[model samples]
Target: MRLAPVSLSLVESVLAKPVLDEKGMILVGAGVKLSERMITRLKQLGVSSLYIEDKRTDDIVIVDAVSDETRRSAVNTVYNSMLSMIETERGARRASRPQIGREISRVFQDILADLKANNSGLINLASIFTVDGYLYHHSVNVAILSTALGLAKGYGQKEITEIGVGALLHDIGCTKVPQEILNKPGRYSDLEYELMKKHAEWGYEMLREQDGVSLLSAHIAYQHHERNDGSGYPRGLKGDEIHEYSKIVGMCDVYEALTSKRFHREAFLPHEALEFILGGGTALFDLSLVRLFAKNVAVYPIGMTVKLNTDETAVVVSLNPEYPQRPVVRLLTDEYGRRLDSPYDIDLTKELTMMIVSYNE
Candidate 1:
């Protein structure tokens, strides 16, 4: 059933997932196929952007023209901001600049402030794709996620600021790796992989040369990938041998990488990524920290739809902290084929009779 063009509010209330149209309307069910026409009409109506559903009605289509002049300009601006941050940091390494560390600290502090302020303009980083501005954008995401993880653990501002600094510079070693090897679209030779591994040592040397900079922050670049079972790179330090901060950073780093698209592979869905991390456990990560992250993070965030084990479909209306993976859902229909309110909260964990089949991204 195709839908008539409706207001964004109407779409939000009725749709099972976030609709993607460039126009201000929500297309429902079979009506979703008309997204392109909806966008054209919305543009004619002076709407800036709109959301729609995937062809299968399982995921939200966030429509933003990569080629749109206005969006392109914003992409460039954000990308440049990330580049400038990384470049200044590199310059700090070469000059052994004291101010760089403080500046890094300040930037992190600003992000925390903005997060706490519940900034009206802040977009959920999870919903946005990092393809347009990979490195700089990835850095920001890591810092923000890591910082949030830190705060959730009751860290003081000083410690949180330090974690932020560590996260921002955690990939400094990547700078030393040859661009040809780093950016290779194809698989690398063993020799190339060996060269890539040296980034840890290179990053350590770069940060060590600076005065008054925290050594732990520098270590994060080298140690973030080192696993708890001694299977990772460089030193291969085993459980407890890895620093606490590095453990947290590693969890965040891997999570970000799994969810992000790379030249090698498309990003995994968040739940699938979480499953991979869970499999790693004490072998690849600290067990406790991994659980903490999984607990706090949204496995299926807002605007997602899901299939219930009861042979019914539903939308994720809210998160259930006590059961992070099994969120409260609004059932579209009961097993007997009856409709209900759009915002019902059925806790799946408690409903042992039901489980989430798959999430609608």
Candidate 2:
């Protein structure tokens, strides 16, 4: 199967992966052949891409770093926790804040276990989701990405759990912000922007009051926006003033936000998002964390199409864990744009002369 943009062309194609809801339930299951109506609905739901069945790439498989069960549980946990917090704030019901913290921590352990058992040692968060589910999915993605970075840095289990929990709840403060501002499709006015920026302090206050949440973890919510050069919000902490855990989560948060399709703009491809992160190294974010992120993330995810500098087109077959920028690709077309009768695979790390020029063809 291969990843393709959602369009009329997918009318007769079968879905290779399931499209999930905010609750982590499968809205459309795999192996379901799509109709024009289904495709139209997907586009309306803000789905920009889909993994469709293709005999040519039948052997290609895209693996998630975490298991399906774990992912479902994580999303559900985040959704419930955030909703409960929001309701509590509105005086709708009394919520056990400590219990919320404990529940999130438990789910983080499951996510950590899955990441450790994953042999690929690379992160792929190209899951299909609806726009309404963005916050729930984004929380889980950030946690997974941050945990991957922690493992790459050789952090112990305790440290990993701390950072993982912190990452999972980094945006908890946003629950306090008005729904209009949070879901605004365009730029924010100055007053709206100021209100938005207060989420960090709000989140810190909430998390710090939870019995199960650590002070260090609460600080992650507080300082995740703090820049390495003292340009970030809430506090102008520079250099070593920002906690290392916050630095890790901050980078992952930016990368996840960029790669996700939004109301205002199309999602940036993995490679394009990486360039943005690289460009901000040492200025907007910690340089060391940015380098660590670029190393572990799959710039060109499996089953993604690319046009090589050789004027050939190929599908990424697998990741070269040590060099994510260079993946193993299976050629699909020659320079002349003719389909090849016999497609062949090449490892970009070995073929140094060839490079990917464009993707999503």
**Best prediction by lDDT:** 2
lDDT of 1 by residue, 315-337 (tens): 66556667767766766666554
Best by TM-score: 2
Against the true structure, what is each candidate's TM-score? 0.69, 0.95
Name every residue pair that clashes in candidate 1. Answer: 2-31, 19-51, 19-52, 20-51, 20-52, 21-50, 21-51
TM-score (C-alpha) between model 1 and the true structure: 0.69
Lowest lDDT 10-mer window, candidate 1? 62-71
Q: In model 1, where do residues sit more than 4 Å from their true spots?
A: 1-93, 114-127, 210-212, 310-313, 331-345
